[model samples]
Target: MQKKIFAYIMSVLLITLIISGIFTVQTIEKQHFSNMEEKLVSASYILSQVLSEDIQADNIEHIKAVLSKVSRELNVRITLIDRQGTVLGETSYDPSLMENHLKRPEIQKALKGSVGKEIRFSSTMKLDFMYIAQPIYRDDYIAGVIRLSTPMKEIKGLMKSINGNLLLALIPGLFLSLLLVYRISISITSPIKEIKNAAVDITLGKLDPSINITSRDEIGELAKAIDFMAASLRDKINSIRDKNTRMEAILSSVVNGIIAVDSNENILFINPIAQKMLNIDEGDIAGKHLLQVIRNNKIDNMIKGILENKSFEENEISLNYPTQKIFRLNSNAIKYPESDRIIGIIIIIQDITEIKKLEKMRSDFVANVSHELKTPLTSIKGFVETLKAGAIEDQAAAVRFLNIIEDEADRLNRLISDILSLSELENRKGKTRYEIINTADKIREIISLLQNQAVHKNIDLIVKVEADVRMLHGDPDQFKQMLINLVDNAVKYTPEGGKVQVTAYNTKNEVVIRIKDNGIGIPKEHIPRLFERFYRVDKARSRNVGGTGLGLAIVKHIIMQFQGKIDVVSEVGQGTEFILSIPRET
Candidate 1:
């Protein structure tokens, strides 16, 4: 920039100097030639008057003498010519050797009674000269012509001297001009240099110490503008960083996993939860292709669909790589601002395995409740209709019909009660009234209540509980109910002579109760859903045996409410054992 400015300044000054020198030299030369012509013409006129008498009388010697004396005094060449273009006398050249003077421009004008002047190269003298001629008159008739001539060398010498002086002045003037131009250029460009550096710093994220130009000129205004731009950029950068920080925090804290990929399906960002959901390692996956990282065809294809369509979509997909997990995935195309072109894709994955299971459970619960209620109502309705339509006339038949109706109604009531209890347990939060109780005592009470059923079935019921396992913190009634349901299910399911045993023991952190029954054991397929509401391995046998189908569900819910755990081990024909772990002190 400095070089360019210097070159521009020097070029202008050099051109100005050159043009001024040419114009000055030309004007001075023109003025010099004008004055020289006037002097030559005047000299010619004056000598013509002096030489007129001599030319008329044809006195060559006298004419020659007068012409030579005037030539010496004026330092000009003198020529005398007659009207016939003959050279009469000459001071510098031999008169006989000269060309016909009458045909010369100046001599012809002199013959016409007018002074004429010309500058030409003389072939005879072999030099350049300025010539002036005037006619001499004798008694009003043209006698001869007198011409004055000056060598052009003298004027040329004067012009050369003047041009030399101009060149000398030009050298110093150019040097001074270049220096001034350099100073002015620096003044203009120095502020611009600072602004350029400041702009560079701003790009590099250095937003302090703005360009300092104090001059109240365009450069200073530019500096102020740069300062303003830097300030604005700093604020914008900080705001972006702050917003990014907040966005990261939000993404990190969200329960759903978030992942962003580019149009080419290259992962751009992956939140912490996304890493866990995708079963990816806790390392950087950015810039890696999504298929390479996750290897899930469904997810990759969904992202491709979003990119192609530039729209939003949601799907439920299962990942079987690390584990079997169901996820509800929402994908959206990320676009350039105000444009439809897709730049990337954003996907949110929410783990919905538990939710799906719960949904299935809810559907099954509705179907089972409807079936349970309908069967009993159908039975009661049939029996009541039988008694109403002439069966009442036979007392034994009517009594038997009433008993059948009462049993159906009682089963229906029990089914409805169990359903409502299970629903309350699931929906209610912090509704358990907890109290300290004895684990062994609860088991003994449950056994005593169900002893009659066990006796009727001819099954041996045994209770084994350690003394230290007595104390446990839970809802006393719930714990008692949980024990009764397990024992009753055991007795109800056991064939005659099958043994049912209840055992309670204390561990470091918990009290455990085990109910073992050598009944027709449950199938392996039904073990997973044994605690589900209304899920019976043998539906006909369970209903005929007066099992509500919700007994184990209620027990499971009570244990869960107490933050306890329950596990069941059952074999097809060997036996089944229900183990319950309750926090001893909680």
Candidate 2:
């Protein structure tokens, strides 16, 4: 801006100087020309009056004398012509070569008693001249004339001298203008350079609010304003940093899994809890697909629904890891502003494996314990009521009520005993140490104990084992109890004359024990919840057959404590197969 302003100043100065110089030269030249023409004309008249008297008398001596004197005084040339057009008198030039003056243009005009002026070129003089001739009248009659001539060549010389001086003036004026422009430019540009440096430093993030202040003009004010702006900008940046620091701390400390993604469903950020839960390798998964990195299909599906159909998603999904544990995934989606367009998805994952187990255990315990006790309690109440209503007075009614009460009580006792055994199996910390042993001998021992019951029902109870089954690590007493549960369940569920088989073998990492029985098989929907407490495909039959409803749940907890897995396969009315796969301990 300063450079441009200085350029404008220089331009205005140069134009003004050019216009003034032209007008000055023209005015002086016009005055000089007018004064010179007027002086020459007045002198010619004076010479004509003097010649009028001399020519009327033809006095050659007086004319010659008068012409010479007038020529010397005025610095002009004079000539005289007679009525016959012959050269009568002349102050300069050769007389013999002179033409007849009577018929000449100036002489004829003088003879008519008038003054005439003309510009003409003279060959002898070799220049242009302004010639004026005035008539010498005698009593308003004819007379000879006196003429004055001036060479215009001298005026050309004068103009040339003036132009030379003007040229001299032009060089110095231009030099001075340039010097002025340079010096003033520095005055304006110095402060500008400082401001420019400050702006550069500020933009590059080096300096803040420390630009130079050089003047009291508009430039100085602008510098102050910029400095103030830098200060405000610095403050805002600090505030943002503080806010971000706080947010980061909170995000890190959270226990539940949190992940934030962009509009593309790319993982922008994931908290430590989420990273650990999902088995992610990197702290930052910026460009990876949310599902690809986290390996949760539910996360991908939920985000797709929110982005495509503008719907919300929440569901429980299962996630498994090779070495650590299994997870129950509960995912949720939300639109920040429900009315506005959804920009991205935020997913929260909760480790609900333990919560699910505890919930199932609590609910099952209540239902099982109540049902087990309710049967016996209700039978006793009925007997007491019958006695109160005089049924006790009839011996047959009393005997029947007493028999029902005793049967219900016996069912209650069996339920308690099974519950105790299951509780003991679940409490591995309270159980004895484990050892590697041939569990086939112990399985055979349990088959012998339940063999009479199997024969009474005409069932074929078979025990199959590897010819040289490898020893597996386990607690003998608990192992035998596990065998008892399997054999007992098989005998109770299988029809008369059916085959019940107990098989054992050593798989690479562990020994697998399978119990297959020809019985009513389980349905597909009941397979998953079979290990849950109080869960049974046929509740009335399970209870009528003296099932405590805590057996499978207890078995599940025991297998988990031993770091093992169990599965059941069945088809309704065909048979049931229970496969227990336990890891061989070191």
Candidate 3:
């Protein structure tokens, strides 16, 4: 801006100076020519008066001598012409070689008894000249013409000198003008530069309210407007930031995952929940295509459908990549406010994996309970019918049938009790009773109670409690029940002369109890579902051993109440080990 202003001002000043100089030189040249012409006319009149007598006498030689001397002194060419249209005397040229003077414009007017002035090129001398002619008279009659001519070169030289002086005068003026223009440009552009810098700072998120411009002109007004605009922009940006922070908080706190995409299917936003649900990192995910982040076809299809239809859509999608999970996707098209133009889509994702598992468990549990109850009731009914059908008269047969019925009734009662206990555990919620339990005493009690069974089978029952085994914190009855179930299973599964071992120890943060047996081991595939209700490895053997298939399931519920984890290691015939790790505190 400074350079442009300076250049513009200099250009205008130069143009004005050039025009003024041209006109001034022309005026001075014109005045000099007028003064020179007047002088030549005066000189010619005086010379014409003096030469008239000589001309009348016809002393042409003497006239030539006199004109030559005066012409040399005046630096002019003098010519004398007769009225008969012949050159009489010439200073620089011979009179005989000169052209006729009667046809010359100045000579013609002089012959008419008046002075004449003319400027034209002289063909004989090959130079441009100014001519002034006066009539020479004798006895008040026209005798001849006396003419004086000077070359135009003298006038041109004078003009050249004038032009040179003018140029010299303009140099300092030009420099002074440049300095003034520089100061003016700085004054105007400095304020503009301040405004520009301030605008740049605003773009970089720096808002300075104290923009002190002291001028009262338009530039000052412009600066004030920009300062106000900056303040307004700062307020607007802060407001937007606060709103965005609140929106992020709300989205993070929500349980359901949320995603938003633009019309081009690029990701606009994704909450943390959505990032976790899709098993994707949240960094730099915005503006990426939806399929590039989450490769699930069901979610992509649902979003695409919402986009194309510009309406709501929903779907339940199962993901098997990161983990097996069922997600319920609810999607709807986003539109411009108060307008129907579709802009993007918003999707809400609800994880229903746990809910679906619970539903399935409830259905299976009902069927298993009915089947287990019906088996024992059918056996008892069959025995009773057999006794009624003349089996009572056969004394030995009736006694055997009644004993079998009693055993079936006992098994049924145990099954019912186990089912009720499992139901109670499942329905139990909130914190459990935290009682300090002696680990060695509990293991001993379990071993003692199950020892008879182990003896009946001729199996060895071993118990080990490490000295460092600390007291565990949990419901004492639940802890004891959990151990009994595990010990009993070990005894029941082991064949004759097989060994069962129970070891209790402590780690830094947990109480570890391990029950291992060298018995008819379970298959690797069955270990996962070993604790499920009514699950059995061998149905016939389980019934013969008076097993209800609910013991391990009950033990699992108790461990869960104590916030403990159980792991099973088994092979077809080697052995099975159940490791229970309960936290030192509830």
Model 1 alpha-carbon drift over 4 Å, by segment: 1-21, 38-75, 78-116, 121-123, 133-147, 157-429, 455-460
Question: What shift in Å separates residue 385 of candidate 1 from its native position after superposition?
Answer: 9.1
Candidate 3 C-alpha lDDT tens digits along 273-391: 98998899758999999999998787788777777777685689999977999999888778899998878888899999999998998899899889888988999899899889889
TM-score for each prediction? 0.63, 0.55, 0.77
Clashing pairs in 2: 85-100, 85-101, 85-102
Task: List residue ranges in candidate 3 displaced over 4 A.
Answer: 1-22, 43-105, 120-129, 135-153, 156-253, 281-285, 308-311, 388-395, 466-469, 505-511, 583-586
Question: Residue 198: error of model 1 in Å?
Answer: 9.2
How many backbone overlaps does candidate 2 show? Answer: 3
**Model 2, residue 507: what's the lDDT?**
85
User: Candidates 1 and 2: which is better by TM-score?
Assistant: 1
Q: What is the lDDT of candidate 1?
A: 0.86
Residue 267 displacement (Å), model 1 = 16
Misplaced by over 4 Å in model 2 are: 1-10, 23-153, 160-364, 380-407, 420-437
Q: Order the numbered candidates by TM-score, best leading.
A: 3, 1, 2
User: Scored by CA lDDT, what does every candidate get?
Assistant: 0.86, 0.76, 0.88
Q: What is the lDDT of residue 85 in candidate 2?
A: 67
